[model samples]
Target: MRQWETAYEKWKNDEGLDAHLKQELDAMHDQPEALEDAFYRDLAFGTGGMRGVLGPGTNRMNIYTIRKAVNGLAHYLKNHCVNVNDRGVAVSYDSRHMSKEFAVETAKVLGAHGVKAYVFNTLHPTPLLSFAVRYLGAAAGVMITASHNPPEYNGFKVYNEDGGQVTPDEAAAITEAIQKTEDELSVPYLEQEEIEAKELLTWGGQEVDNAYLEQLESITKLDADEQEQTKDLQIVFTPLHGTACDLVQRGLDNLHFHQVDVVEEQAVPDPEFSTVDSPNPEEHQAFTMAMELGKQTNADILIGTDPDADRLGAAVKNDTGDYAVLTGNQLGALMLDYILRHTDPKLLPNARMIKTIVTSELGRRIADSYGVQTMDTLTGFKYIGEKIRQFDATGEAFIFGYEESYGYLISDVVRDKDAVQSAIFACEMAYYWKKQGKTLYDALQSLYETYGYYVEDMISLKLTGKQGSEKIARIMQAARTESFTDIGGVDVLAVEDYWTSERMVAGSSQPEEIDLPQENVVKFLLKDDCWICLRPSGTEPKLKCYVSVRGDSEEDSRKRLTKLKTAMDHFLHRTQS
Candidate 1:
């Protein structure tokens, strides 16, 4: 019998397993495909930590796997951190199935290792988790969420004492320790009562929340009157049935925004996320309820946050009396402009911003217009957060950081992308524009007219299971060997292979070194400053193609994007053939 099949047999017969899990295992006994997929391999941490379908398998996220992962983390913390009993870990969960349970399970595992655990009293947003790490003076942190993934999935993200996501070295060390945590099923999860009695566990809520809320005032540049006047800007807020409803509503209300209306259906947390096709705010349909509420209130803007409230999506009323969904790039650029308007970089000479390499260059352009320097990191908010720590000194200041996927951070109070902060600032931006006799759409148009119309789009091709993985690898290999002169008849200015950390200048044999970490990514810079980037998504089973273009007008930019997408589609598909 195969390794997985043998493992399945053991699971079916093990009396140590929970009856509920045993029943689930028995039902899948006849389904070889299901069993194989579940036990073929353990779900390892990716850019967003270990995320997979929740069920009774090594590959799935369940109490056992959670215990194993926590065991590894406990060992890692012990090896690297001192004073573990004092400066321990801060833990929190989102509104997902088993989220609360996982939080307790993690705390129990830590307690077994003699580490202190400060867990939230209830479900909370991701940013709060980040802040709690710093607020509690923890040596590390663990957040239980699959940020924006479907309800069937749950994940775990670890943070170091700096409140940033674990660095590559940290992840590797923890992974190694986890590999040493043999017999994952035996990893003990102590009872909560015993754990608390031992002083290894404590519940944290109101204190951390009030402190987090108080930090919001630090990110806002507006004074008392300015905040009060923002009440005139009619806006609709939706948490998408996740965790942001309370925090965002309070942020807006505290800012004295009188017209803020939250979508009632989405205000409460729901593990099922029954409102839309998915809880991700990046998808236009996720904003459906918020838009409905916007129309009902005749609101000037609409904002929605994903399940964990780490990602945000916003729509602004256009000239046609309809709400137009703003791309993540558009919103980022707008936020940059609005932020700089309030932040005087002249006095803060070391002020700078950070963004991902695949994000729009329009942000760089906007920052340059104000004499603020912008830095680029590889994809993932962790890199940006890392930069924040590196540059967070007396001289160097972090103005703001954002990703093209609707993640933004105005302050390092939380060392991750914060939708709560973004939503607050976005609302203030809309209101600031409204006070200027302009709509958010109008403000975006003005940005384009000034910086040249910059448009961006992404295409993700899904391929599932083992065969799909092999096919994807082959395509990436083809990209390595193949060369192209032009895409859509536009001459390729240069080609950058992030895997090699080398950039091949156009018409030149020599390659330039790139000062970024090596990853499976490639980019082509075109003659007219347009660009295309290709890479497999770190957190999903899909290959993503990102394209950005800057043209004189919106129509011209759209035409260029369409043509480039067509040619790129043909180009990539040919590789598989």
Candidate 2:
């Protein structure tokens, strides 16, 4: 018998797989490429968790695969805990295909392993899962979401006890445990009724939602009166058919932004995300419907959230009354400036902020101007969450946290990025600007004037499927190996290799430690304040390169960015060739 056929036969003989999966296997019995893609290797567990295309395979995010991951987690918890079964885990999911099912699978696996599980009764946002973990004092949390991925995709994100995504060390431990598990079907799982009867499964719904919303309210700087005056401020919002519609709308209402309008067609939950090609809010095309609604309503601002609603995107009326989509950096800088200006002095001294190193340095300058200390972490909200936890432990107040990819966290109550919080804050900012007879575009331009024209752009080189994965790894390796002396007529002053945790200065043999968790990333700082960073996307088969340049004028900044982009593109193409 052929190798794949024999393997397929063995898999068919297994009793652990349901008829559905067995049928799928049978359908793909003759498809060598599909089988190879399905079982070439197991889906890897990275720092956050395992994420992949959902299908019936060892390599996909199926029930069996999820069960394996949960069993590994359960085993890890058991080994580390004094009372393995009693220590619980919280679970939540977004409005992706099979997200709720995946959450239930996770809970069931935890329950069967004698670990208690608290699961949301319906679709929930990713940030709430983080909040629920800490609120329930669980040992860990699991969120079933693919964030802004296409409808064909889904994922799993694991959080530590502190309510942050799992760190490298923790993820490594779990990955090791997952590797030790031989057969995914062998992992135990409790039936839903049995788990409920045993009192090991608890349903979290309105009670947790109420508490989360209450905590979200506490993060607001605008009072009811301020919101009352600005309540009529016209705003358009779209959740892109994910999980944020109700929470974001409710939060805005509670804040008294009564004129907030939802893009009705896109507001409803849709696993297929039929309205848009992709649900990512960062893309201007994703906001087409929202922008149309904004224009119709004469809305001052247009806001969008990804499927899970942890990240936010905005568009504002420009000088000509046409809508202009603001980058994450622009939105963040505006928020930082607005919050600092209106907040009390007592809040200033204790207030601090964080952003990923790849995020715009403009935010740092804005924070510094207001005497707010800002720190940089490696890419990912997990590091930002880690910083928040450290600050909370040391009595330092967290003013804000964000990444360049539109994720922001305004409140400490939720350890992950909170789009619900961001939506409210953005509405308040818009209202404040409207009361002043100014637009958010005007505010952004003011920020640019003060910060000296900063522009940031990201390029993602997509590699799909198994072959794409190998290419991505090769690209990262190639970037690390190559040396660039100059870019866009600017001399490279330093190269920060995150994987080695070392920064090599120009003309210096010695390297300094970066003092952050080590990861596979490289960043080059140029002499003219232009920078480029290269890193692989954790959730997708892509290598992301970020470029930031600051100039004395907007035109100058654009020119510099274009030059840098062209040079980088040529450089990348040449290297790849």
Candidate 3:
């Protein structure tokens, strides 16, 4: 019998399994392919923690997996944390299926080990969980969410005491601790009554909400006069049936923005996310309801946040007088430009901005124009948060950090990508430009005119199941070994293999070491300073290809991007086959 078959049988024969999981197992007895997919291997847990579809399998997100992960976190904390008994874990959840259940179970698991659990009384956004860790002085934090993933998906993200996602070393240690559990189903947990009696579980949210709002308020660079002048700027906001309606509304109110309109259809907390195909703001389809409302209300701008409110997306009237969603890269440049232009001159000398390797370089150019240094980290926002902590220690100012996937961090108080703060800031920026008689889209055009036109796009190809995982590995290997002189008629200048942390130029036989951390990524530098990068998604079963090109005009940039995308897609398809 195969390994997966053996594991399937082991799970099938266990009479002590949870009732719902047992029912699911019995229903899938005759479905060999489904069984294999579920039992092929354990759901991966790494720096991003564990994320998977919700079901009854080793590779699924269930109560057993959540327990096992929390159990391991508890073990790792005991060994590494100081005063673990007193400094408990802070827990929060989004409006996903079983999110509350998972969070409550996480607290119970920690309570079973005599550690306290400070959990939010109700669902909150992911960034607030990051803030609660430091606000409550907890040892660590757990956010029960899948961010912007589909309704069937869920995740568990771990955070360090410093309010950022756990570092790679700490994550590895936690993974090691998790691997020692022989049986996930047998992990012990305290009941709600038992935990409460022992003072192991504490529920709070309003205080944290107020405190977080205060911090958000303090980060506004605009003075009272400017804020008062911009407060009436018409705006429409949507939370995509997730956990940002209350806080974002309250936040805008604090900013004295009285003309804000909320998309009532998507403001309620919904586990199914019924209105859209997916809750992600990266896709334009997610803004359908918001756009309609924007048209009816004649709003100046439209903003939407994903389920957990960690990513923000916006739509502005284009040259055609229709709502057009701005790409993450374009929004990043806008925020960076507005922030740098408004920040105190004395602070600019010590200020720094960070972006992922795959993000557009237009922000870098803008930062350079302002004399602010720009740093690039690997593809995760955790690295950006880690840099913020480092800069805090070294006395450097972290002005802003963003990813091309619509995640942005405006203030370091909330270590993760905060959509709440970014949403308000984006509105402020829109108003700032409006005062100058320009729309946000108009501002983007002006930016392109000042700096060169830069266009970027990401192609995500979903390759799922065990076979797909193998194919992704093979594709990465092929990218490293294959020789290419040019792509889309452009000469290849260099090849950067992030896995080896080395760059090989066209003429240099010697490879230069990269200053960033090693990751499973490769970049092909092309002529005219354009590039293409390939990396597998850390939290999902997909391979992402990012292409960036510069041009003298918008048409030129779009044409270059199209050619590069066509070539890269062909390469990926050929490799997969």
- Which is the leading candidate under TM-score? 3
Please tell me which model should have the higher lDDT, number 2 or number 3: 3
Across 78-156, the per-residue lDDT of candidate 1 in tens digits comes to 8898887788899999999999999999999999888889999989998898899898889999999988888898999
- Tell me, by lDDT, which candidate is best: 3
1 or 2, which is superior by lDDT? Answer: 1
User: What order do you get sorting by lDDT, best first?
Assistant: 3, 1, 2
Clashes of 2: 0
Order the numbered candidates by TM-score, best leading: 3, 1, 2
Writing each residue's lDDT as its tens digit, candidate 3 over 1-577 gives 9998988888888888889989988999999999999989888898899999999888999999999999999999999989988999999999999999999999999999999999999999999999999998999999999998889999999999999999888899999999888788889999999999999999999999999999888878778776555375889999999999999888888888879989898998898999999998899999999999889988899999999999999999999999999999999999999999988788888999999999999999999999999999999999999999998679999999999999999989999999999998999888878879999999999899999999999889899998889889989999999998999998999999999999999999999999987789999999997999999999999999999999999999999999999998999999987
Against the hidden reference, what TM-scores do the models get? 0.97, 0.96, 0.99
In candidate 3, where is summed lDDT lowest over 10 consecutive residues? 224-233
Candidate 1: list runs displaced more than 4 Å.
228-230
Instruction: Give the clash total for candidate 1.
Output: 0
